[model samples]
Target: MAKNGKKMETQRSVDQEVKAICDIMRRGNCAGAMQYVPELTWILFLRILDEMEEQERQAAEAVGAAFAPSIEAPYRWSDWAAPGSEFRTELFEKGQGNVFAFVNGPAYGEDNKTSLLPYLKNLEKRPNATAKQKVISEVISGVDRVRIDTERNFLDVLDKVDAITSAAIDDTHVFTLSQVYEGLLLKMGEKGNDGGQFFTPREVIRAIVRVIDPSVGETIYDPGCGTGGFLAQAFEYMTGPKNEKIKSADDLSVLKRDTFWGREKDNVVYPIALANLILHGIDKPNLWHGNTLTDQVGYGGLFEGAPPQFDVILSNPPFGGKEGKDAQSKFDYKTGATQVLFLQHVIANLKKKGRCGIVLDEGLLFRTNEDAFVKTKRKLLDDCNVWCIVSLPGGVFTSAGAGVKTNLVFFTKGERTKRIWYYDLTDIKVLKKTPLVSKHFDEFFKLLPKKEESELSWFVDLDERRKKAAAEASPFKKEAERHARAAAQWNEKLKELKKAKPKKAPAIEKAEAKQKAEAKAARLAAGKAKEIEDAVYDLKAVNPNRKPEVDTRTPEDLLDLIEAKGREIAKVLFALRQ
Candidate 1:
């Protein structure tokens, strides 16, 4: 009990320290949460990396294995960050030759090294560099020198960051930092930074991950990996109790080192993605910093090697943004829309049988007017089994700086879609203040694989759908005429039966009643069968070319009319028996 209490106290301390650091950065006028979050991310990253390296070193020594540090001694977090420490007190404060000038001055870090930035950039080309070293260099190369004007503020931020101890790497405490970082990213997204292109809401991210169900060893990639939310959640899902595919340390090492990959175009957002993954316990995430929409020049030119293929993909690519001619030229079905290009990129890069869950605007589903849009859907259906589309309520993403109605599309490569299941949550009233929660998707998840018909859930078989589209000249006209004649004949029969006299004998009346009951059951069954057949015809009238007034009644309402006529026809049959 005492040990448990101690752990709780430590966790609280780390959480409060992070909150305090964010408060200090905000008070120091570091340009609000948006600017300071990135600054904070770097400091926190370096500190966290230092702590993790120390842990690794200690573990290696316990096992009698030689360990080489990723960062050289002079540039490690402990070397320069602490006050009155070795570099500050022994080497720099006493006017040691070229010490201060070399550490912070803006110049090419040559001979012995000039500044932090230069050394970090130079690590990219270092011979036999580890993946960890490359990640650190990539993060630092994008960051400008500390923008905080006051030395006191900078040092204070460092002190608070250092308080987040090595214990934070524990699964329980580490997720606290991930949550804090996500909140800051949410603020950036809310402010419409980078047109809110990379920010997918955390709730939406979880739903996609849960549905995609990535296995432990399977590779997961996100092309437009904004802050690495999908990758992080995939990690969480595989490591959670429900995962059985991961059974050994080597399997875990595979997850940490190579299971996840991503690409991001925005340089400002790239560091945040790296930090996010690191916080989630991914030791070395294979994230390429480039525009995924643009085609790679050649082998090892843009992408590290040939295009990376993945077993599962989860992404919410930017919607409605227009790409340039250069980007559009890369896709076979050329379009200026950014999502269209991403769709093409995802389809092309997925391995055979790769499963993907993507968030897209509603326009992609029903846009049949344009050639590019039509062809894109055509290719999607022909090349993949698009099993489900869950339409989210409107304003579900207003908090994330997007107000467009969106749908989550789940598909697997290598199988042409035979039927598509759709669930509509549009009427559920999701707002910026009261946005969508997991409960909003409960019904969707329940009805998804079953493809059951509910008020909001329906299925569309592509083969029958194609035939109806082809018959739009007069699709429902013949069915409408046949049903009208049936109704008229039933009405006449009922009138004739009501006009006839009833039998006077009690025995005859009882026999007639039994006959009527049997006839009623048969008529009711036939009516239901007809209703099922007419539902498809009713859908045909919904085609854009067909007039709505041609079949104003829905299939359900028409079924009610048929059942009413069936009862009257049963009464007429009883009169004939008498």
Candidate 2:
């Protein structure tokens, strides 16, 4: 039934239910999306966990195997939160019990048991606790009490959230709880929001996942797993119904328990990531809560037995992040820029013949001025087969509040890059209303099989171009070396003459002149050599097949239009003043 005394459809009612929960949170103390999302995340996580555990318990009982529940009674959703449960019944019937006092206070009832928050927070301290218990403790670590101010508003949110499940959604709609949570994440990442920095557009993640095509038994990782988007999408792609890959029982076990790994540094986003992966049906998401660059460990109980390297890596690390010297000292190609350092880290964390798809800014591709950036790129070219580079539109990240131009880089380890195929989408106009979608890359994947060349796609033979540059730079480099050696000999001779003569003389003056001339010649040769050396390392994608479009507007027409627009603006301003 609808609030307006009419019936609504399945998907529409489900959406309304989720929105109504957010409306209640907005009216409560949890005002902002950043605040309300985290509060909602914990409750949503607990609701789904209880349902999943109940299903597991039934399966265990059918198999005649003993099973220990992750969460016990009175604290579980069925004990206190489910509709018509003991706690809910007592709370509403003659004020026999208080839901708020039961959840967030010292011993309040006749049983005199601990509160829900304190009980969850102390689960990790128990001897021989299950992994699920440890995860619950981490997710509920900072939540000392409920965020909703009033008990009435809190119970309203719980009731609305309880109505949202697979039973409420129609089979024709193909909706899931993960999709509902994805909507909340999208709201967190909209324009003018601070949480936008921790999000990547889902369409972009889908494109990268399809191109990578992760397998069932392979391991996937994300170093900066903001809300675990990449890992969860990979899980979806691997287990999707349309996939033709065969899944054995062993493969299914590995996929459920040991296939995903990630690390997140943020305090709030880390717990949300754990809940997100668990919501996506990943039983053991081996995530470390800390900084990957600095190796600062916050919590590693989940990631305790992780291996050295992974088979496939997909990530969109934080853009425009700047680290300090503490993180810079850990890498050989040291740089304060976050993306460059993460690029190096990715290259090091791959197994032999492993594949990777990463999102990088355009600046890192063309930057030769910084030694760290150039050297890291040079390592990438030497260590991996960088097969394809796609230039995404400048506004692809506009909804996430990032207006920088980005590119998708695909590569495989254990081979050197000889050629690079580039697909250009810069000509396509992207806006906040119209964004870059999965369909935009259909042609890119179509042309990727043969590395075909077209108006929007081209390839560069990296080996041949680099050989030509080296051949051209050889003579100047030799000349520079020869001049440097001569300059050193002349300086030595001048020093000997000064020591022997014990006074200034013509020989000393003559030696000084020869030394100065040799140094000047060396400087000239070195300058020319450096110019060619930098050009060889320049890997910016510039399509040779496409010609620059020329503008036909003459100077007179442009000036006249500018003057007319200025006069119109002045008239509007004059009217406002009058």
Which candidate leads the pack in lDDT?
A: 2
TM-score of 2: 0.91
Model 2 pairs in collision: none
How high is the CA lDDT of each candidate model?
Answer: 0.72, 0.85
- If scored against the real structure, what TM-score would every candidate get? 0.75, 0.91
Please give the range of 10 consecutive residues that has the lowest summed lDDT in model 2: 1-10
Query: Which one is best on TM-score?
Result: 2
Question: Candidate 1 at 25: error in angstroms?
Answer: 2.0
Show where candidate 2 strays beyond 4 Å.
Answer: 1-12, 91-97, 106-112, 241-246, 505-517, 520-524, 550-578
* 22-111: candidate 1 lDDT, tens digit per residue: 778877777665678788878778888887898999999999999999887677888877555686455445453444344455652246
lDDT of 1 at 372: 70
